[model samples]
Target: MSSIVKTNKFTQALSDCIRSNPKFKAGQSYADLSMWTRLCVGLSDTEIFSMLPIALRNVWADEEIHPLLQERGAIGTGRFNVQSLAATLVCFRRTETQNSEVRVLQSQLAHLSHEFNSLSFSVFDILKRLDRLEAENVTLKQALNIGGLSDDPAGLPKTETQQISIRSDQDAVTKYVL
Candidate 1:
């Protein structure tokens, strides 16, 4: 048989298989399937039109798409067979699903990353406040120590031990004025 005849038969068979498969029929329109086919194979319109049945067969028979095609009972041989084409379509569909899932996951990761940055800033601010407070506490403790106050066993200043000192010169001035 001529290669052109085989290619047409193969294309028809693939179309039939897609229509018969409930998942394929429900998930994509003919136009959508066509577009996806081109996208998945990264082929131009002229290249796709001129592609041989063997080339189409090889695409579906790839290691990635073969197993899925077999699971769907769409594997076949010959120019009249649609199994290869059906497999290619299924593979494209799977790729689309995976791409969508990846997008969702990426979005979630971005949100989480943002939240982590915010939390880090908050923690840093808290640490800075704690350090400032610690320094102030140390300075206050030193001042209390210099003011003739002793820290009790409970870590508080002993207020009863505090005494006011008066200079003798000031006392004599008060006596002279009186």
Candidate 2:
């Protein structure tokens, strides 16, 4: 099989793969490396990638993407290559999978993740405020010499008798900040 003369990092890797892997010793060949010559054929890789759904676009630079594709694109510079997209297209086309549904689901998941993080931070802030208010409540109760289960009916776990002991008519006069 004829080897590609226009060698680059991507082509070299493909040639190495053809030579080393046992399954390709007869079926595939260095001739396949010519595919890399069209890396930017009709349109720039960015334009082609932008035309694709996010599912295929992910193959170029995702941390979870295969090493070959990750190497083909520059994540820092947002550079992409037709070789990577073509490889990804071949893999997906074999399964006859639709990428639009995948892209929609991924978008929903990302949105949910962002919302969950925002809600988690809000909940954390609320808990901190509650703790501060509880502390303040302690000081006020101690200074006023007040005691009651009615103060915080949901206080520490208690036996029925303990529950009865802390209640008082003073619940009517008590002021709670929470």
Candidate 3:
């Protein structure tokens, strides 16, 4: 009837739910307590205290310890009804925590992807510059002809006729002069 009674019932029920949960481990005791506290925040102060420990008991070393702790946490007054409320609270807290972690991971992944893209583009730019340099080097080698005798003519490679088409006006002028 009173807020304290309801809160106690909630807390006991919560502890029982925790003990039953398969996801949690005894090693994560601090997490267990914190989760219990968060769950209880939604209920009345008195109900929260009653239910908080019950939820905490749910985190055990194994199945063997779980039943013992579950019994201890749920033995008090208003045990039956409040257990359900405590279980609901735990589920809510777990989901909320999981969702928050997912969002954080997604943001980190996005940042890494952006960095990878930038690095890839930079590498492509460098490769493009190198290719241009190679073409230019070939052109320079043809022009210089280092160590070639002036008269020992290895003539430059001939351009195709299509590559250097004569102007029609120039051809006409040459013909008239001839």
Candidate 4:
């Protein structure tokens, strides 16, 4: 197959992948890194368009992409050389399998990220419910004039529950901000 077809096909495949997964938010670091990694792998270390298939060579060499890929080590600036591309390919291609493993790990991280996002939302929801319940309880206590504050706030389990709650709450808050 032509490298153009191959590169286009690869780009499309990556695009489809990100599109299918809601977790792979566009413009995010993960998306950028994934794209760069694919480009690094697909472009065979940034040789000229001629070195690739005739159709696909100049397709991605737009002003915007040229510098970006160069920065990512996908392409060299100005000219294209088979030797450079070969060296780069040799150096990086060896790592392709390892990179594949990293990508798998990254995908797993993405899955965990989705899970953590869901769980964090759930935790926040529970905290909101707890707040509402606590408010209602306080109202009732005030209505009944249940006097005397708890003498031992420190008696609350300071170990497991509190730690988990604090960590979860912090995580939720952090995710929300992000």
Candidate 5:
């Protein structure tokens, strides 16, 4: 993993950023921001989200918003008070769109996982039934005295003689049971 950059001071980085992009108005609001917010630059994108400036401050004081407006013109600055931010969000009016989409995707994933597990169980059950059928087939072949029988031989087959021999044995066993 790459090392985190601790050396880029806020003032210097801000100046460097604004110099490169003349239209970037996001930096002016961040000048008096908490250090925690500044440190987040390394983790998050270089460009500020419009909502982030209001969220990061520990306090939502109106006095804080007033100073930033005096330092920079209103156009490039979004140093907003709580009331203004709430009003702006009200204008946007699609607050539930992102959250609802995420919830829908998560529920879909859960449904698919449940279906896959049930299918796996069905496959296992089929394999067990096949094994039971194979066992029954083996037992029937042994009872008929054909368990050792091979394919039709070049000479006379032994299976006919074996079945004939077992007939007498089965008759004697049946008499004993009676």
Candidate 6:
């Protein structure tokens, strides 16, 4: 069969399989069914049909399904099995759930990054203010003669005056103000 024919057959088979089970019908929405179909994109109809028995035995067996399949005479017809179809549906649901969780985490991380940047700017501003305050404190001490040379020039220690003058001039010029 052509690829298009095969795809159509596979689609029909999967739909029929899903309709056969009440659990799949009630639990899955149209969107969920579409997602399950998308997950089967790479598989050929023959391959998918071939997996039915194994899928039914391993993944989708239930008392209700068995009676329904028997009533329709679909059991042992070499068609799509519930287990096989369920495996694909389960995988698609899990992928969607994880993607949603990842999106939530990414948004949270972006918010945290913004908060950190704002806090960083605030800290920088505080440091600048502190530097300005320290510079003012030094200037005030000198003006009040609280920690500088004695008022009388004759009373100054000769070596200390030279060092103090040079240091104070540099401090006055380089002091940072906010």
lDDT of 3 by residue, 102-132 (tens): 9999999999999999999999999999999
Evaluate model 1: give its lDDT: 0.58
Which pairs of residues clash in candidate 5, taking residues 3 or more apart in a chain or in different chains?
A: none
Q: Which stretches of candidate 1 lie above 4 Å from their native place?
A: 1-81, 153-178
**Per-residue lDDT of model 5, residues 10-129, tens digit only:** 334544443343344333243333332433444333223333343324122335443443354433233454335334333233333466788999999999999999999999999999
Off by over 4 Å in 5: 1-79, 82-95, 146-178
lDDT of 6 by residue, 1-178 (tens): 6655755565455555556554343123556456455645666445554543444443235554555545544444333345545565556655766989999999999999999999999999999999999999878767757656656675566687788997888888788531
What TM-score would you give candidate 5 relative to the actual structure? 0.34
Write candidate 1's Cα lDDT for 1-178 as tens digits.
6656655555555454444553442124565475446443543334344453454466465665455556655435465443444455666666777989999999999999999999999999999999999999899878888886655455554355332223455677899999
Error of 1 at 25 (Å): 19
The candidate, 4 or 6, that scores higher on lDDT is 6
Model 2 residue runs over 4 Å out of place are: 1-97, 146-178
Report every candidate's CA lDDT: 0.58, 0.46, 0.58, 0.55, 0.48, 0.59
lDDT: which candidate is best?
Answer: 6
Estimate candidate 6's alpha-carbon lDDT, on a 0 to 1 scale: 0.59
Predict model 3's lDDT versus the native: 0.58
List TM-scores for all candidates, in order.
Answer: 0.46, 0.30, 0.42, 0.32, 0.34, 0.41
- lDDT at residue 84 of model 1 (Cα atoms): 41
lDDT of 2 at 136: 99
For candidate 6, what is the total of clashing residue pairs?
3
Worst 10 residues of 4 by lDDT: 48-57
TM-score of model 4 vs. true structure = 0.32
